[model samples]
Target: MGDDSIGGRLSEFIGNLGGFLRKFIFSVLSVGPIPNHIAFILDGNRRYAKKHNLKEGDGHRAGFVALLSMLKYCYELGVKYVTIYAFSIDNFNRRPDEVQYIMGLMHEKIEGMLKEESFVRSYGVRVHFLGDLKLLHQSVRIAAEKAMRVTANNTKFVLLICVAYTSTNETVHSVHQCFKEKRRPMDKFQEEEQQQQQQGLIKLVDLERNMYMALAPDPDILVRTSGETRLSNFLLWQTAFCYLYSPAKLWPEISLWNLVWSVLNFQRAYPYLLKTKMKRY
Candidate 1:
């Protein structure tokens, strides 16, 4: 046989072996309670780029690959909802060139998601772009809207990408919406009752329903890469009961082992987390 044929066979065998191993691992994890929703804070892309002596955009490209791998692992493990803090409002303060580059990258990725054979299609994921999408470039905004429209029928999984978003902004926007919605010419008695309940007027449910993240339940596990402990204004309102796992690896350095370790930690804390969640509700 030719050497090329032999090498191709060997590669295929290794790929099959890896797939088997992953399935076995996932089955074992299924014995424990699987998280219904998980969120990610994708940090350290620039740092990863600098560390690896790559060009400025290369780190982000690498991070994107890591994101895909992590998503695959999460879906295969039966995680139905996955949210990612893709871009924060604060990120716009960076160098103008850098901001434009990131926006372009986002636009590219969004277009990729619309492809028939893309990850969203394979996983039956309905894509949601949360936050102030108006702040996005016109083309990117249109693409994002199209993606949501196309994926509207998908029911198996959900992917929420938060771009131009901050928890404080979400809160303020929700509050404003609540008031605007509540002030629509109520009856005299209703207005009087609302005034009386001014101290407790904006109920939690009202605010929650208005928030951009209302479509998905609160995340059960929030994994922030690069050992960062702070929420950095991301999901501050939603993560009140979420379990956080921060690995030392940078975003691009994230691997299957990191995901597995995070899942193991989550399983260990599942009981306490459940109890805490129950008490809060």
Candidate 2:
């Protein structure tokens, strides 16, 4: 055989060997117990779009695609619950045109999920919209409701999408509901309420039952893409003990490898968490 032919064959063999090694590593990484619930703060959509010189809607579209891919990976890793921060209450403060465009994209994404061949159906993923629905546009709210209704019966996985959600607002809303349901007048019960408060009986959990995502398990791991370190008002009550993973990649650029790396990091740090558990109040 010619030297060129032999070299070409060797190159092909090396490429195949590398591919096999990568798959083997991923499969091994998938072993052992996975986080039962994983939450993602999907940030940097607009920044990604601007960096790529794409339109406002295009960034969100890319983000949706990324989310769909991530969901499949989560299921493969045996994660039963996934929550994503899709939209924030503070987002409504953006330019009116941008807000309208984002709402339209949200509708499109929900409609896409409703199609029979979509990932939500194939994976038996149940959708829940966790947010203050009243603040959203009527059309977007309806689309969210329809998506949740369609996926209500599925049990394979729980997908929580936070739209127009603010942790502070959710907490305040819960407090308001608690007060509205109080049987005694404020003046008459003021002393008792203060006593209960001192005893920690009137704390956030007393009102948490009324907040969105109340039924879902708190996230074991909270990941924020695009190198953002802050939680940005996501799941304030739910993420009380979550292990946070902030990767440098943008939302649209996140992949299974990134997730695996996060998992490995979590595993390494878990012993410290275990040691600290006794001290956690």
Candidate 3:
């Protein structure tokens, strides 16, 4: 046999072997306890598009398909709550054309979620939109509302989609609502100050009814794609102690195997984490 032929055969063999190993590892990782609520900062779509030399819209389309696959894996792993960072308020600063395209894509995906054949319906998933709804385009807002209304009755799993969202905005919104409920007149700063002083302390329960995620449990794990290490203003109040993982893959490249790996890593670290919590108590 020629040297070139032999080298080609060897490369194929190694590639196949690596693929098998990855599948085996993913299977093993999926067998253990899964988190009840997992959040994701779906990043790198634009970068993925650039690298692939595709249109900006194509990257988001690919990411949406990747998300569907991840949702299926989450259901299979018994995850009851999944929160995804679909769009950030910071995203609004992008080029107007790009942002418009993304908004259109968001509408399309939300509409798609309402289809009977959607994986969300098959898995009995309830959908919620968590964000500043007023900032979105009217069409996108309606699509999101429709998706939530249609899936409101599903009981198996909960999916929270964050669009036009920022942790700072969520916190400020909660505080604003809290004050509004007390009916403290904006003109009466002295009275409001006295009332706050009299209250003495603020607690999570006090803010519960004011926050957007009031009914949902805090996420147990938060995942970010494209190897980003920062929270990027996602779920700040709720993720006070959530485990965080940033895998090296872009949003469009995330797979079942990556999800499994993150879960397993969380499991390995959890016992130590519990011990630390117990010591504090």
lDDT of 1 by residue, 1-281 (tens): 99999999999999999889999998998889888999999999999999989998999999999999899988888999999999999998999999899899999999999888899988899999999999998988999999999999999889999999999999999999998888688887988887898833678889999999999999988999999998989989888887899998999899888878888888999999889889988
lDDT of 1: 0.91
TM-score of each: 0.94, 0.82, 0.82
Residue 194 of model 3: what lDDT?
60
Q: Tell me the tens digit of each residue's lDDT in model 3 across 165-232.
A: 99999989998887675554545676777677765345556687778887587787899999999999
RMSD of each: 2.1, 6.3, 7.5
Overlapping backbone residue pairs in candidate 1 total 0
Top TM-score hit = 1
* Best-to-worst ranking by TM-score: 1, 2, 3
Q: In model 3, how large is the Cα lDDT of residue 4?
A: 100
lDDT of each model, Cα atoms only? 0.91, 0.84, 0.85
Over 121-230, each residue of candidate 2 has an lDDT whose tens digit, in order, gives 98998999987888889999999999999899999989999988999988888887776655445564786776676633455566877788786877778999999899
Sort all candidates by lDDT, best to worst.
1, 3, 2
Query: Whose lDDT is greatest here?
Result: 1
